[model samples]
Target chain A: MPHVQNGWYLAAWSDEVGRTLTQRWIAGNPVCFYRLGDGTPIALEDRCPHRKFPLSLGRLDGDVLECNYHGYRFDGTGTCVGVAEQQDKPRAATRRFRLLERDGIIWIWPGDPDRADESQLPDTSWLASPNWTHVKGVLPLKARHLLLVENLLDLSHETFLHPSTIGNAAVAATPIEVTTSGPRVFFQRRMVGVQAPPFYEKSMGLTGLVDRWQDGEFHPPGVFLLNIRLAATGTEEPEGFHMKVLYGMTPSTENECLDFYALARDYAIDDAELTTFQHEQQLSVMGEDVDALEVQELMYATERRRTVESSIRSDLAALRGRRVLQKMLAAEAAEESGGAVPATR
Target chain B: MAPAARTAGDSGQRIGSPGADEEITVDVVRRRSVADDVLELTLVRPTADPLPQWTPGAHVDVLLPTGIVRQYSLCGDPGETGSWRIGVLREPAGRGGSAWLHDHAVEGTELVLRGPRNNFPLVDAERYVFVAGGVGITPVLPMVHAAERAGRPWVLWYGGRRRSSMAFLEELGGYGDRVRPRPEDESGQLDLATVLAEQEPGTLYYCCGPSGLIDAMRSRCQGMPSGSLRVERFSAVPQPAVEEPDGGIEVVCRRSGLTVAVPPGTSILDAVRQAGVDVLSSCTEGICGTCETTVLDGVPEHRDSLLTEDEQEAGDTMMICVSRALGDRLVLDL
Candidate 1:
């Protein structure tokens, strides 16, 4: 499937972009990201307008970026400000994207600049806020972005995929509520008066039945915010433990994606040992996903036409999410083609 | 300006209403291109009844044919109950909301509009200074008229990319010297420093615009009288980073009759969730104002962007998504 082109995607972490040029593919578009002298980030088409040279191979001179091939200097706005040994500055300038930094992440809009509203940026404050100590890492997956999105939206896979860490029978046993709003879909599942899973016992020290809740919100393209909560069973108390997991999946190519993961917690503020434990545990769990997804991608490629798929009740949220993405993609196509919008049922 | 009252429910529904799920549809009676890339839409109720009364800064959510809901200010006079008018700027790079409105929202088209909720209500003041940038002049248009009708001294500093791109120019022509229309093509950027230099004691400063313009006005009005500046933000304010606490704290769930030790590097939210208790939360960041939990007997370290300084000082609730307990143990209502 073709990736959505006209939305904000996580380009890189703030630390990843600096004076040195860095190149990454966003939704199959080659782009280069760099920061100016004052640390304002900029994203431009990786290919230079002149000879289609990758700008990432160029050198930075203050706010001006000089293409290594021809020494063509471009300003922060992607306007070609200088040319090598040329008396007149040419009107040739690379396409510049809207770049925004929020919560320690740099986001780039790959589509229309007129529609690049900063407010449309996904909220990832929990990962960047100081009150929550989080473990952050990037996982380059061989699977498509939509597959990763489906995996994230369907928490039922945890029982089988992450049996040692965040999995339990209750996840499959509990009923899920699938609801949608605009381009976002939400999956909420609550397992009331259920036995505390081993992960909860080891991490939270819960011994008896507990009320566990898992809520995941899916944003178009590929972004998910998961809110997990646990409390003693039969308790009306509002005081409960909670954690937020943020997933930012950026499609680097048709078959590859960069998954930015952040697991933030409200309980433990600054314990290095806990961070290490959680980080190690997550790495092991995510390693399983990475392994499984790679094989799935291979199978998808091999049996491109022979494969058949089926959906269960648990896949409702993922299915809704897919439909929302399809509609958005269709709308974008219609707008580009100047055709009538697709009819709604 | 008072914070826009945010109704939290699923989008495309009347958030606070009970059993009233149907949308209010209105007929687009007239559509005119007021300026380049700007459109003025006049809407009236499908019935003979008058539209809901709205304050000067009120805005209605217009549901477009493209399945996107956009908020547009009520620029028409409040006294005119027969119809409502809104100005929309066609943002070429936007998410298709404005473009759909500019292209498809024409005469005889029916649109669903929700709420004339005023987050930017005009306050009582002896004098006022209004500053607007580009398409942000919509909300201020009605306020200027209200100021004129009340016989209050007021001045408007409106600006856009050029003369052609600025809307409602003919409407402001009646105000003469009181309205300063600064088109960037003819004049440079608005001299905010010069306009705000003279601080009138009772003058309430109202501004609505892009972040750059708002930030300029904020810095310029720093030394002026406190509470004199009011702004309507089209985007969220950047949150300040909080320092992580050093050690784990014990949380006492009063009703659950349980005490959970939140190990270091974990949040109270994570601990509670791990314990199997679900809290209503959305943007797990402090920004969305979701996951706000009441603190029954302990001081909460507030890190959310939704609360004001005074609310933070009160220490009644904290956004669990990114906030933690201050002391070793916290007694919570949850």
Candidate 2:
């Protein structure tokens, strides 16, 4: 019925939250993110309890936030530390979310504090490793998080949606294998002895037929890891180009989501020009996805009722991923209802 | 040019009462003295609804309890939606508006406000130079936060009578050297000439202060570049007169289809309003750009301090309150 709360969502990039208080929305809740004197990042509800003024509008005295409105101050723990000319601070406090900084990203947990588990955080170690060159970008999408999740889980759209860069007719023409292990859904597609896409041609210097393999894994509530390898045809050499593209979709509202994407590569680690070129190419492809998803969202809004839709063989991975999310949501609802056995849709 | 007979019976609308709009009431939840005479008032909507969103450099027109309307910059962060903050400097020798706000406006008082209009908007630049004096620091406060958030280089030269007279000094201290607080007593007068020297190519200058500081910065920035300096003025500056036309000015209201002749000593706004054409106006002086009218076919003698020289030269729009027609017959969009 609503967004699954007991999960990690990307709050912002590591560099975005700094000395000054920054405000962002996660799961339709306003959040204020800032760092302490020792550079420890903190996430708290943006609204002040006294007059509902955003703590971000306030100034920071070390780690304490002073509300610019009436001078109400809050500590890093969201406790009311001081009030102007008043002693004995009231019990007024804002909600403090669990925040973790890892792998150049800040993760926030807006669910029950006791249920927050650090182990559940997505693995993004490649983005921080010096061995791999990475380029990251953030896009605010008008579509729902589920729509973006589906868009990333299915690779067939690449052939049509992204024709210039990563797209080719072979991606849609080739059959894909779908499998699931626990909460992870995997989609594997192989195109052998096919023309190299324009993106690989320019980036990898491939001018002839090549063997391309795409293996994507979806980890809910919204993380997609796509591993791609391209090598010369009829050769199993060790000099093939490999890339790891990671996507993290965090829902800002019911109908809005923030897409955080990082493209990492093991090859061409020293080429800054290649990194810039790949960054622009990735941004262009993502822009195309956003355009398509926004239009799909508009169609869904106009047609309130869902009609009978046809599903192809390539949609198996997306369907499986949706089912996993549904199970998670149902389990969360059941737990909240004191294990009384909630109805599953 | 032929002289047209002046048409009479055209009465202008009274000032302050523009039209009937929804009255949004906000309660003064908190008030505190931040400086010697400056007070910061935090106003919040009584209902649970979020207040109107505003950007940096926007100001709201507050209708004081004494029925006096005054515009104050929303100095609070634009990210805050629940409350709006305004800093007021108590003027002893001037209008009673600021005095009434200082003496009577207190916490828990409810005030009706009209707008959060932004006449001074911050544009994108590689670097920014902010010069504020006395109460003029209100609008520049939020802009500094914006520049910091954007990770752009900026320097604020804030001047007041004394360090104790400046509001938000404690808050500005967090920014460290980026904010230069110049108390007139300790730092002498602001050496705007030296500070503004060696200007960068894409550096934008924003100055809001007394007339002397504004004029000094204006002259210093004359040779820099066009549209490089943006200054907000509290009072209107005297505009040079255009060569007078041979006849009385004829203004044709395109929408209302009324032709009125405005003789010498009469403004085009008064002439148009006299013909039952209602045009919104605030601050009858050309300072407030409220009575700005679009020009269809006319060369306007621009007198308002709102538009830049290039904008006035384009002649697409003119402030009808003070500026008049340069030719005998002119057409107005009305």
Which candidate tops DockQ?
1
All models, DockQ values? Answer: 0.02, 0.00
Colliding residue pairs in candidate 2: B10-B274, B11-B274
Candidate 1 residue lDDT tens string, A10-50: 88888889989999999888998998999899999999898
Listed in order, each prediction's TM-score against the native is: 0.52, 0.49
Q: Supply candidate 1's per-residue lDDT for A231.
A: 82
Query: What is candidate 1's CA lDDT for residue A343?
Result: 38
- CAPRI-style class, candidate 2: incorrect
State the lDDT at A86 in candidate 2. 73
lDDT of 1 by residue, B1-334 (tens): 1111121110111112222223568999999988998889899988947887777877776666766656677899999998999988877666677777777878999999776656567888999999998878888999999999999999999988999989998999999999999999899899897788787789998888775786677656644544566665453211111112446777777777767788887878888878877666666666544466877765566655544332343456777877775445677767
Superposition error at B111 for model 1 (Å)? 33
Judged by whole-model lDDT over C-alpha atoms, candidate 2 comes out at: 0.78
